[model samples]
Target: LTIKTKMLVYKACVLRRANLPSVTALLKQKRLRWLGHLSRLEDGRIPKDMLHGELSEGIRTIGRPKLRYKDTLKAFGIDPDQWETLAGDQNRWRQYLHQGIKVHDRNWLQRLQEKRVCGKQAAPESPNHDTYACNHGHGSCKSRIGLFSHMRHCKP
Candidate 1:
């Protein structure tokens, strides 16, 4: 069996063992795998996020809600113009993927919308201390802040 098929089966077994929703097993696996793959891409962006099983099974799953290609491309940091040919021609969609454009995280948008409507706590309020530090003694240091303020008088 192909890796995709194997992954689906494995996920099915896991979900069955866990007593979760086995009917949507394959769909959940596909979405998770897509996100995992995107996180590893060179561009640091997600791929074109499709409605779970849309293009995976093609015409057989035609009734699935397909995402807007333009929005998908934007989420992945790809210029929509770069996918102009694919955007305009349905026949070229698969070919356009050969050019290395990625889909967005399909579940992410849905979750964001749900959070908004349900008034749930959305994003984390805290920042990563290592990345956004004030440039000094570490851990959002006050020393760094004093240094930054003292540096304003120095000429380049």
Candidate 2:
């Protein structure tokens, strides 16, 4: 797509036509799959240990805390308290994962559509190029860009 292409437009047209999942969705799927794999691993395995490990030292610097893997799982619609139980059964976990992904994608698309609609509703009307003028009343402008440039320096 060209640099001038709107991201929302590109996502709706190109990605839908190509039947591709969004990069974020793919990453979420991979992470959840790995999490499920780790969940089923035998106890004392390094990966499993690390997945369940907690920091014992080093005080947090403060501001906002870093995001944890569990946060992503929650974002994927899994409850942190019950994720281990859910992941214990491979078949159930697989089904749950697919359903979660579908729900997440649908919600994401709905939000995007809402954003596009709200953006269109809130946008200012375009000025007529032939008679465009700065709000500060510098003079008439030949184009939208010229009007913006003039507005920058045309102080009231």
Highest-scoring model, lDDT = 2
- lDDT of candidate 2 over 32-141, digit per residue (tens): 88999999999999999998888999888869988776877776788988988998999988888777777677777888999878977866877666687777666788
Cα miss at 155, model 2 (Å)? 17
As a TM-score, model 2 comes out at 0.64
Summing lDDT over every window of 10 consecutive residues in candidate 2, give the lowest-scoring window.
Answer: 1-10
lDDT (0-100) at residue 103 of candidate 2? 67
Candidate 2 displacement at residue 123 in angstroms: 5.3
What lDDT tens digits, residue by residue, belong to model 1 across residues 1-156?
233544545443454466444333234334433444443444533353332235545354558676554454555444666544334443444333323222233344355467666775565665444543443433342355544664554344
lDDT at residue 80 of model 1 (Cα atoms): 60
Off by over 4 Å in 2: 1-8, 59-66, 123-156
Q: Tell me, by TM-score, which candidate is best.
A: 2
Model 1: weakest 10-residue lDDT segment is 97-106
